[model samples]
Target: MKRNIVILASAITALCSCNDGASDKAPVADSSEVKTAPENNKYTSQPLVTHIYTADPSAHVFNGRIYIYPSHDTATGTPENDNGDHFNMMDYHILSMDSVGGKITDHGVALNIKDIPWAGRQLWAPDAAFANDTYYLYFPVKDKKDVFHIGVATSKTPEGPFTAEKEPIKGSYSIDPCVFKDDNGSFYMYFGGIWGGQLQKWNNNKYDSAGKLHQPDELAVLPRVAKLSADMKSFAEPVKEIKILDSTGHLYKEKNNDQRFFEAAWMHKYNGKYYFSYSTGDTHNIVYAIGDSPYGPFTYKGLLLAPVEGWTNHHSIIEKDGKWYLFYHDVQLSGKTHLRNVKVAPLVYNADGSIQTVHSQK
Candidate 1:
C-alpha cells in the first residue's frame, strides 16, 4: 500500500546496551524517553524501542521468546508519491524480548538490500517461519526491472545473519508476504497489495505497465494465497486469489475501499478457525474475515483496529502466555509516515471467538 510523505526532525532518545541473539551489543533507547504520538486519545501502548525507526512488524514466538522482523526505516530524503518512493528502507533488524514491555533486544542487521543480488530497492514488509529446524525469512522487494518479487532467506537461529538464495521465488509477485504454518506442518503464504504494491498491474498474472483497472461494479482486487513447498523455498502450487465476502456472504465491490483489501495480509488461527486480517489502505483500518480453511472464501467479520495517527496501518497477532497481543507501527516517534516505530498492545477475543475492536492512542 502507498504511504504518505510526512517528514519531521527526529527526537533522539537515551540509548542503552543490551544482549542480542547474535551476541552483539545492539543499541536500544529507553522507551520512557520517547515522545507520545500527536493524538487526542490517551495510549497505554508505546514504541518497543526508539533507538531506530522500524515499521510493518511481523512478530513470532520462538524458543519461549518473541522475535520481531520489521522493515528498517531510514530517512533517505526521497520525495513521496503514490508509488511509495520515499520509503527508502534498505535493510532489516530483528527485535526480541522475553515478554512484552520488557527489555527488548535489537539483533542488529539481519539482512540488507545490498546483499541480495537480484534486488533493486525498497525492501518492504517481511515475515519469518521456523520449519525443519531452520528459520526462514520471507520478504518482498523490487528487482532490477522495478517489478516486485518475494524472496526467502535462511538462518540457523531466529535472530540471524541470513543467507539469501540466488533468485526470487518462482511465480511470485506483489508485496507483503505473511507465511503461516498450520498445525499439520504445512505452510501457506498470504500476500498482495494495490497501488504502489503493484497488484493491479498483474491482472493477467504478469506485469503490464498499462494494466487494466477493475471497474467500480466489478469485484475488488483479491489477496493471493499459495502453499509453500516442503523445503519452504518455492510455491507448491499455482497462486490462487482469495475471495472476501461481506457478512451477508456477497463479494466486496471495487468501490468498497473501507472493506476491500489493500495490503499487509496476516493470518492467525484460534479455536480451529483461520482469521485473515489486512489493512484498508486509504481508509486507515485493519479488518478481518474468518474461514474454515486457510485457502478461503472468507466471510467478513468486522474491524480489528480503527484508524491510528498515521496514513497506514500494518500488524501481526500472536498469543503469548495465554494472552493475545497485537504488534503494529505508527508515526508516533518521528511524526513521519516513512519513519515509523513499532508498538504492542493486548488483543481480546469475545466469548464467541470474534475479535474485539482495538483503538490505538498516543
Candidate 2:
C-alpha cells in the first residue's frame, strides 16, 4: 500500500488511525503544480500521467505498447476523514504510453470498487498479466473486516470493462499482487509484505486451491510462492519462508534495515538469473538481490533506486524493443506525501550483472 513513512506512516497511520479499520480518505489537491519533464536523452523527470493523482505503478507491455495500471488517488470528500490525509483509493485507471518517450493516454477507470462484490473502499496497488489470450488484473483490497485479500479481475483487452471475480484468490492474504510468467510458460504468483514476503511457482500450468495462506503482517513470511491456476482465480503449491539474504550473507530479517527488504516484492529474470527487487520499508529506497533460482538463497546486491521525498518507492522493470525502463511514482504533483504521480526513467544494466542506481531526475 505505500513507499516510505508518509505513505507507510500514512498506511500505518491509516491502519492505526481508522477506528473502523480502513484507509483514511485523502484531501483533494488544491492547485498543485505539475512539473513538465524536459524532453531529453538523460531522463524524463516529470510524471507520465498528471491532472489526477496516481500511485502504485504496475507497468506491463501489451500489443507493442506500454500499459500501466495505477491506483487512483482521490480526496476523502469530508474534512474529518483523516484530515483528508490518507491513501484513499477506490478504483484503478489504465494509462498507456503511446510511444517510448512522452504521450500518456488515460483510458479511464478500468475497474471500480462498486463493481467488486467482496472489496472494501480502499483499493490499493494492482498488477496485470496477459495469458491464455486474456488480460488478468491482480488487485489487493481491504475487506470489510479490514483484512486485505488478493483478487483477480479479467478483461478481454488491455483497456477493459473488466469483470472482477466474485471470490478472491484463496490460500493467501497479502497485498500488492504481482504475477510473472517464466520462459517455460509456467505462471508464478509473488506476494507478501512488511514482516516478510512469499513466492510460489506453478505446477502442471495451473493453480491449486488448497495451499496455505498468511496475513500481510505475518512476522515469519519470506518470499513464498503459489501456483497461479490457469483460471486465474485460485492458487496452490505454497512454499514457506524461502530464504532471502542480508548484506552479511545470512538470512534476511535477522539483520536491521541496511540492505533489507521491507516490502514491495518485484521479480525479474535476466541473463538466466533471478533478480528479486523490493522497496526498503523506511519507504525511502529500493534495493535488490540476485539468486540462481526464482525462490532462492539470493545474495544481497545493491540499491536499485534512491529515495524520493514523498513516501513509497515501488517500482517495475520492463523491456521494450531493446531497452529497459523503470516505472515508479513520486509525490511531486501535490507535494503531499500520499498524493503521488507516476514517473518513468530509462533503466540500464552494468557489465557486472548488477543494476545501476536510478537517476530519475533530469
Candidate 3:
C-alpha cells in the first residue's frame, strides 16, 4: 500500500536560553536595529510544518524545491521513541517544500531497512545530495550488537524508494553520515560514532582502546573522512580518520562525568570558508570550527548552540538564505521520549564571521 504521511511542525513556545555564561539577560536581538529584507527573503520564526520525530536533518534546495532527508524511526517499532535506543530504522524519509512559504509534504519513507542486507533494524543520521539525475542518501546502520556502520543509497526521484548499494562504503563501525560535493564536483563522506574496537583514545592519539599505546584504530568513536569514487559507488581511496574533538584528557581527569568528544559532522562551504559543525557533550550542544579547505587544519570557532536543559541539540547548521536560519531538533515538552522534533530560528553572525548566537522563538 502506498502511504503519504504528512507530519507537521506544531506551534509550541518552549523557551530555551542560549548559554552566555552567568548572564540573566535574554538572548533576543533588538528587532528595531535589525534590518528587514524582502518578504520572500526575510527570516521568520514560523515553521512550514510540524509534529515531526526525525533528527539529524540535512536539507537541500533541489530542482527549485526544498527537500529534507532525515533518519527514519519507525512509528510502530520497538524503542518507538528517539531516546538514543538502537532499533531497526533503516530507512530515509523525504519531505518536500514546493515554495518558500509552502507547507512541507511528507512523502512517506524514501528508503527502508528491508533494502539493506547488513543493516540490523536501526538507522540513524542521514544526509542527501543530488548528482547526475540521482539523489544520494548517506546514512548509518547498526548490526545486531548495535555497532554502527555508514552506507549509501540512491534513487531517481527526490521522494524515493532508494536502493542501497550491495555493500557499505568501505569502513568498519561508524554512523552519522554526511556527504559533501565540492565545487570541483568531488564527493566526500564524513562520519563516525562509538564503534566497538581497539581505536585510539579520544582527544589524543596516545592511548589505544585497551589503554595500550599504539596507532589509532580505524574503528574509534572519533570522526573520520574519506573520498568517494566518481560514481559514488565505492571509496576511491583509503579512509582517513580525522579527530574532530577529543576529550581523552578531560575524560581521564573528570572520571566521574561522562565526557563526549566530537561526532555528527556536517560541512558547508560559505564564502570560500569551510565550516564544520559537530555534536559534543553527549549530543546536547553543538560546536563548530572553520578551515580554508574541506580537508583541513581547522581552528575551533567555539559553541554555536547549547542544550536547553530539558532538551538536546544534535546535528544542525544555518540554512543560508538572505538571512541564515539554524535548523535543529528538540524534545517536545508534551512527549516523554526524545522524538527529536525540528525547530528553526534566526542565526545571527558577529563581525568576525563567527555565530554570535541563535535565538529561539518565544
Candidate 4:
C-alpha cells in the first residue's frame, strides 16, 4: 500500500535549509532481497524482466547490490506523436538484481501518479539517490496546468513506498531528474528535455508553447543543472544551463540533433573526470561528454551506446565489483515504441578512458 505524506510548508523550509550534520554515506541494501552472484557469469544483453513494460532505467549500486528505478510503461493506447503523448505512464516500479544475468525482482508500485497531489498525469522517467540516510526518488510529471515539473519523494528503504512532497520542486521545469551525489558530499540535479519534455518552451525562462529550437548555426538548447540543498528536497540556488561543446570548443548547433541534447542526462565520475551522457533523441544515439566539474562546459567525447531497436533510449552506467555495466531499454518485447523493456550489458572503457560503444541487438 502507498504511504500518505503530509507536507507542511514550515517543515519543508526548515528541512531544506538546516544543516542536519548527517553523514553523507551511501545507503546499505537489505540482504534479504540482494545476494552476491559469482564472478564468472557477469555480462548480459537480456531484458531485466518482461512481465511488464519499463523504460529509461536509472541504475545504482546501494551497498554493492544493483537497484533500478525505471519509468513504468503502460499500454494506454494514446496516439504517438512528436509531443510524446503515447507514453501514458502513471506510476513507477523499482527493479533489483543481485548481478547481471541473474534473476530480477520487481518491487511493484514504488510510486503512483494518483498519490502525487499536484501531478495531473504522465509519470515519466525517474532517478533515485541516497543521502542523509534516506532514499530519494526524483521524477518528472505534468501539473494541473499541463506544464511539466520535477517532484521528489522520500522513503527509508531502497525499494520504496515513497511519500511525495506536497508541491513540485520550485523552478524545476522539464523532465528526467538525475541526482548525482559527489564525493565531496554535495548533490547536483541535472535535468531537461526537448519537445514533449517541455524544455524548449522555457528557453527564455518563461513558457511559450510555440517556442522553437535554435537555428542551425545558433547555440543549441542545453540541459539544465542545479546544486541541491542539504536536505535534497529543493535547489540550493538558481538553475544553470549546461554547456556541451565539441572538440574544437564549438557549440553544437540546433540542426545537429544527432549530437545535441534531447533528453536523459546522467553523470558518472570516471578516473577523476566527470562523464555527462545524454540521448540524441531524433538521431537515435546515446552520446557523452567529459569535464573537470559536474557542472560542465564539457567537450563532446563520443557515442557511449549506439542506436537501439526503438524510437527512444535512456540508460544508466554503474561500476560494480570493478566492472561497469550499462542499463538501458528498448521496444524489443512489445514492438511498439511507447512500450519498452529494460536490459543490461557490459560497458567497456578503453585504457585511455573513452567508452567503447555498445550496439543494441535489434
Candidate 5:
C-alpha cells in the first residue's frame, strides 16, 4: 500500500519537541552482541533473519513459534501501473521461527485477493489473532476503483492457507486492520489512517460490500474499536470509534495539519492498563496513549521515538516469555518509499503507567 509520503518533513519537526522529558541516556548493548557478519551471511543469525522487507508486521507466539504476518511488496522495483486496470497482488505473507531467538523462515502467502470472493486486488496492512484453535487474519484490500476495504480470513495453523470468509468484517475504505482479543474473551478490530475517518462495527457478524454499510460519516476516527462475536466471524455490537489523540492533544495542533498525526493503530493490554500506540507526524515517528478499557477514553502519553534517518516507525507490541517488545519497520539506508524492513526493539514503561521509550534493536 502507498503511504502519504508528504508528511515526512513535518514528522521530523514534530518529533523534535516530543522528547521534552526524555533523559539523554543511550541504549545499552546486549552483553552477547554478535559481530556484524558479511552481507551474504547476515540471514544466518537471529537479528539478520528479521532484516527482510516486510511492512506492517503483526507477530504472535503460537505453539512455541514466533509467526509474523506482513504485507508482501515486490523486492524488484518494477512498477506495475495499478490505475484501476490491474490488481495489486501484494498479499499477506507469513514468516515463522521455532523460537523467539531462532532464525526466521519464510512460510509464504497465507492469504491473497484470489482467495477472497470478489475481493479487489491490492492487499495492504494485516493483523492476526488466535481464538478457539483458529488463527484469524484481518487485512485491507482495494477494489477496481482503488477503494480499500477490510477483510478477515482464518487458518488452523499460523503458517498456512487462510480461508477468506465470504464477506469482509466491515465494508469501507479502511486500512491497517488490527484484531485485539480482550480478557473477557471478546474480540475487537481497529483500523483507520490518512482519511481522518473513524472505526466501524460489524453489527450483523458478517461481511458485506463497501457500499452496503454506512458512509464514512457514520464511522469513528483514529484508534477506533468494535466488539466481535464469540465465534470471531461476526460483530456483536456497533463499531465503537475511539480517538486516543484528538485535536486538543499536543501532537494535533492546526499548525501540524500537514503532518497528518493519526495513523497505524495497535493496542494491547498489560498491567491492567490498555496501551494504544500509533504513528504520528508521518511514519518517521511514533506516539501512544493509555486507556482504561478497549473501548476507551484514552489520554495521550507522548512521543515514543523520533525519526531516525527519515525512517518512519509503524509498531506492534507483544509479550514473549514475560517480556514486552515493540515490533516495527524502519528504512534500511534512507531515501524515500518507506518500504519497511522489520526490526525488534525493547519497550519500557514509566512507573505512573506511561511509555518511557522504544529503543532500536541492538
Candidate 6:
C-alpha cells in the first residue's frame, strides 16, 4: 500500500501515522438502532472525536478504512456568526476508525495554513482521496487578496504532514474543494460558494483575473467543474459551469438560473448513476441531483439530509461495506454556528435512486 504514495514531505518521520479505519444501495440498519450503551442524547455514538471542533467533513475509504479530513474549527479568536465575523480555521486534522463505534484515532494535523505561500488565515472545508497510489488533499484558503483559491497537497499516506504546492491551481478560484475519482479512473474537481460568487469576495466585492476590484454583480460564482490531469495539480480541460437542474425538471426559472446548489459540491457514483450532491446555502438543506455522466445533464432530486440546527450545512456521502453514511457538522456542543462538530449518520437510497432525508437529533 505504501508503495503507491508520493512522499513529498521532508519530515517523513513526523507524519501522523496511526491505526485508521459510508453509503448504500441496499437497506442499511439505522446506526441509532444498533443499541449501543444508552446515552442522554438522541445519537447513539459520539462525534468521532471531541479534542477540537471540526466541520465540512469529507470522508474517504482507503485500504478498508474510513478517513475523514475536516476543517479545524476554532474558538481562539472572535466567535463565528452568520455575518462572517469569524469562521477561523487554520489547519486540517485527519481522523479515522476501523469501524462504526470503534476508537477514532487522530492522525494529527495533516496540513497547516501558514505553510502555503499564497494562503490567508482561513482554511475551510477540504477533501482527500487516493489515486494512482498517491493520496491528495484538496483545500481552499483566501490568498493575500482575500480571494478563495483551491489548492492541492500530496502525501504517500492518507494521514500525513503533507507538503503543499506553492501556487493555487491556476484558473481555479472558489471554496470547498471536493474531488471525485470515478470508477473508470478518471478524476474531476468541484468547487464554489454564494454571496456574489463565493464568500462575497470577502468584502461584498468582485475581482477579475488581474485582481482588479469591482462590485459583486460583475462576477457570478456558482459551483464549478473541471477534469484533473494525471498529475492532479493542473486542469485537463477548461473548467466548465454546471447547473444542477434544467428545463427537464419542473421548476420556474428567471432566465434559466437556479440556486438550488449553494455550495459543498460532492460527487459519488452508485450503480452506474452519478449522484451529484450538495448543500443549498440560504435554505440549508443537503440536496442532490442525478446525472448519467460525470459531467451531467442532471435531474434534480430532493433532500438527502434536511436542515440541521446550524446555519451552514456542508456534507459528504460515501458507501462503506455495503452501507452508506452521510457525514456533516452541526453546532450541537458549542451552541454557536462557527464552532461546529462533525457527525455521521447512515444515508439510504430510495427505490427511484434518490437519497433519503436524515432526521438527526440535537
Kindly indicate the candidate among 2 and 3 with the higher lDDT: 2
Residue 297 CA displacement from its true place in model 2, Å: 2.4
Query: Lowest-scoring 10 consecutive residues by lDDT in candidate 6?
Result: 12-21
- 2 or 6, which is superior by TM-score? 6
Better of 3 and 6 by lDDT: 6
Clashing pairs in 1: none
Of candidates 3 and 1, the better by TM-score: 1
**Candidate 2, which ten residues in sequence have the lowest lDDT sum?**
15-24
In the range 1-362, model 1's lDDT, one tens digit per residue, is 01110110010011111211122244444222334344222443557766778899999999999999998888887899988988878989998988765578788889999999999999999999999899999999999999999999999999998999889999899999999989998999999999889998886567787865578788899999999999999999989999999988898988898999999999999999999999999899999999999999898999998887778799999999998988888876777888888877767788898987766652
For residue 95, model 5's alpha carbon misses the true position, in angstroms, by 1.5
Best-to-worst ranking by TM-score: 1, 4, 6, 2, 5, 3
**Candidate 6 wrongly placed segments (more than 4 Å):** 1-40, 43-45, 79-85, 196-221, 246-259
Candidate 3, residues 1-362: lDDT per residue as tens digits? 01111111111121111110111222222211222111221112333233334556777777777677775433443553333553345556576665333456767668878878777756777888788789888777765554556677899987787898876766534667778888899988876654222233323423333442222333224466778887876778777655343332111111211223345678877677887877654445677767787775456666776553233455545354465546665434223234444545545567777875443322
Ranking of predictions according to lDDT = 1, 4, 6, 2, 5, 3
What TM-score does model 1 achieve against the real structure?
0.89
Worst lDDT run of 10 residues, candidate 5, spans 39-48
The per-prediction CA RMSD against the true structure, in angstroms, equals: 6.8, 10.2, 12.1, 12.7, 10.8, 11.2
lDDT of each: 0.84, 0.67, 0.55, 0.82, 0.57, 0.70
Q: At residue 348, what lDDT does model 4 achieve?
A: 72
- Select the stronger candidate by lDDT from 3 and 4: 4
Once fitted onto the true fold, the runs of candidate 5 whose alpha carbons sit more than 4 angstroms away are: 1-52, 75-89, 171-173, 195-221, 245-261, 281-283, 308-311, 333-338, 359-362
* Residue-level lDDT tens digits of model 4 in 1-362: 01111122222223212211111222223211222222111122445565677799999999777899999887776888889988889888798767665556777789999999999988999999999999999999999999999999999999999999999999899999999988999999999998899898896467787888667787779999999999999999989999999989988888888899999999999999999999999998999999999999899999988888889989999998898878888775566788787777667788999997776642
Each candidate structure's TM-score, on Cα atoms with residue i matched to residue i, is: 0.89, 0.79, 0.72, 0.87, 0.72, 0.80
Taking the tens digit of each residue's C-alpha lDDT, what string does model 2 give over 1-362? Answer: 12322332222222212111111222223333334333332223556655567777888889998898887877655233321226667888787864445356777779999899998757878888988899999887767765567888999999786899997777766567677788887777777555212122222323333433333343323655676777767775653445677667666442345565556778888999988887765546788889887667788888888887576778888888887878788776566666787776666688989886764443
Name the regions of candidate 1 deviating beyond 4 angstroms: 1-41
Question: Considering summed lDDT, which 10 consecutive residues are worst modelled in model 1?
Answer: 4-13
Write down the TM-score for model 5: 0.72
The number of residue pairs in model 6 that clash at the backbone is 15
Which candidate wins on TM-score?
Answer: 1
